[model samples]
Target: MTPRSRPTAGGSTALPGTDFGHLTESTRPLVELDDAARIRSIRSERWIGYPQARSVLGHLETLLSWPDRQRMPNLLLLGSTNNGKSMIIEKFRRTHPPTSLSDREQIPVLCVQMPPEPSPSRFYLAVLAALGTPIRPHSRVPDLERQALMLLRATKVRMLIVDELHNVLAGRDNARREFLNMLRFLGNDLRIPLVGVGTRDAYLAIRTDPQLENRFAPMTLPTWTNTPQARSLMASFAASYPLRQPSHLASPEMTDYLLTRCEGTIGELSTLLTSAAVLAVDTGAEAITPGVLERTEYLGPTERRRQFERHLP
Candidate 1:
């Protein structure tokens, strides 16, 4: 028999065939590995694309190609914490990576996290830091602004993505107003699309400024529910793992249980599944069975909060 047809301990062949038809084409080869290797693979990070994420990526691509005008369009990517906002941006950034020319580096997409307590100077500093420029201590706000704008123009940044944008609300009223005005100035001055990413509070903050609210088109990534799409996502997750046997995670009963336990967030669901897959590999289950899920150690968001409160002094 050929090496591809040889049976492995996980009851799957080394390559794509009848025995490994349940898995993704790329994952089929992983099933033939030993338990330790399979466990390592299960713990590694991977992306599981879904419809919503794909739609967002498509929008981002459109934004990237938008022409520079007096009033460039913008996007507000709103979602709960631990949702896939950052990952989507990261993926987009990777797609259009920085180009190193003989003269200078050209960064088409610039992503920076909003300062926790945002001020004009602090925000400028964050931008400078993200661009790998050295910031002089005790620099004036005007100086910082000049440096940031110069670098942004020099680097030829096409899109600016500000993550944790809700942090703008953390400032006092005057500070918040100043920061919002600064955002407006940046968009107008650079004439590049600005993308804000944060929780719903980001939307609320933007609404306070009518001009910004109108300029930024809002997009949301809501929590998952028990539906055909959710089941399909679960099936994709199952197939991505290198398990020897089918996980059957898309069954109606299993889907409901998983969603209930995960509190309807893809991040938590991924955590739970990763743990279960690890347990499955370690315990010789070779699959994410119901029993394996039960044995897996995980805490849903609400339960974790309640447990923390219970232990409070």
Candidate 2:
């Protein structure tokens, strides 16, 4: 379904031309798919190796290869919610996936989510769950810890990534302190680097414990701005989609409008773009034009929350 282009008035190009040169070579063929297929392709998840994500991945690699030491270095990956912190960690984990040996599996990188209700027992349960161990209901905290640590050592996990770490603050004072202590104990016992991923609150929770605060170097993924890097990111996104014609999303005017509407978060920007791309395909626009974006049903995060509040009983 290649688009056809015709000369317009004043020597201008017409809409919906087969000028998919803007896309990556691998993605160019997708432009020929039917509208439903192209929309499905557009909705699929993909990675954009922007500079900040690359830098974070580099740091994760360094930590993964660090030699065993009494005080292993840790990292605190801080970012706004839905700003790509978890995506970066997932990408790193996939790069060094687990290896199954004759006897046992060797997990080079183990990722666990911090329990919403933070407690040592619940945390160890999360670890055990991630390791694919059967949970014993009503298991004692000590038993859970023993099992978790034993399995961690047996698997030879090089690094542990704890996502949603800001949930640590959800506990009471004593519970929080206990969880912090558990973290220190886990790191010291396993001699493996612990990476914490969450919002700024996670850093604050770490700061409460001086040792953890010192060990974990903070790295942040701030929201996007009207910068060259952001423009490049927009161009990358435009190329990733299977649109037949150029989106011109990297144009300064479009960049400004996108950043403003998406409220500067990559997650919001992605949602907005995906919705607009779907609309573009459905309406035969073949490119994400201003009209396509305007017709999308997507709403920015703030607006969605405000709308929700308005409907509250």
Candidate 3:
């Protein structure tokens, strides 16, 4: 009697006629999750249809379209979370490529996400890294800052998008002073538009640095208020994902439930919806249902409690 090879749980044996490599690849996990961070995209299609989102994009476009003779004004994007702030910046870059014709006129959008804890040295290094510069292992704060500015000048970048400006506070009093000096130096000395983006705290951060604050005019991105605009945003979300289709989520009740749960934050909304879609795909459901949404464990304890309380009698 010939011994039989054992088949894997999915039924096909690896040592036999089946192409195991192809089978394993086909059966690979659907939604890729890493260290509690959901890797969802923030693009127009994913953005809940908010007119303000479009407005923000238009504002950035105007900033980028400054004529040859003038200096681009510094812009401050101040808003609470999920107000489509980052989306606007990204969309602007996509719709309008930042490149100048001549070397002196060359334009580049340098986006740097500020760290939770920031110092002068850290800030300089972070900015340089964001600009794709090679950071020397033993470089000092001043060295990095000098190199960053030199590269910025050499590249002639028109706009510097500093996301999470609140991180400058991660330093000591002296560090903060030095960091603000860098901003002042960049604004007055370099003649490039420096756009700062962060939560409401970002506004306060800029306000503290009088020189930096004076250089930037603040623009606020408003959160959805459950008004007609909210409905329009929901409609936009529907259009983007097309819940009615078999290959996606389709529960109207779940959609309303999501809005209630997320409180109309674009980032939270996108995150929740994307998660639900992924859950549906995982469970072999062609359309998302209330049951699937209920089964999700991604919502934080506080958020879930709020959601539960709101729905309760």
Give the alpha carbon lDDT tens digit for every residue of 99-157 in model 3: 65644434467777876665667777887786667789988877887898888877667
Runs in model 2 lying further than 4 Å from the true structure: 1-19
lDDT of 1 at 209: 95
- Pick out the ten consecutive residues of candidate 2 with the lowest summed lDDT: 9-18
The residue-by-residue lDDT of candidate 1 on 145-256, one tens digit each, is 9999999999999999999999999999999999999999999999999999999999999999999999999999999888999999999999999887888999889999
Alpha carbon lDDT at 311, candidate 3: 100
TM-score for candidate 2, residues paired by index: 0.94
Off by over 4 Å in 3: 1-49, 67-72, 96-107, 242-256, 279-292, 295-301, 304-313
Report, for every candidate in turn, its global Cα lDDT versus the true structure: 0.91, 0.91, 0.63
Could you list the CA RMSD of all candidates, in the order they appear? 3.2, 5.0, 9.9
Candidate 3 minimal-lDDT segment of 10 residues: 30-39
Looking at model 2, residue 312 earns an lDDT score of 100
Best of the candidates, TM-score? 2
Ten consecutive residues with minimal summed lDDT in candidate 1?
1-10
- List TM-score per model, in order: 0.94, 0.94, 0.70
Candidate 3 accuracy as lDDT: 0.63
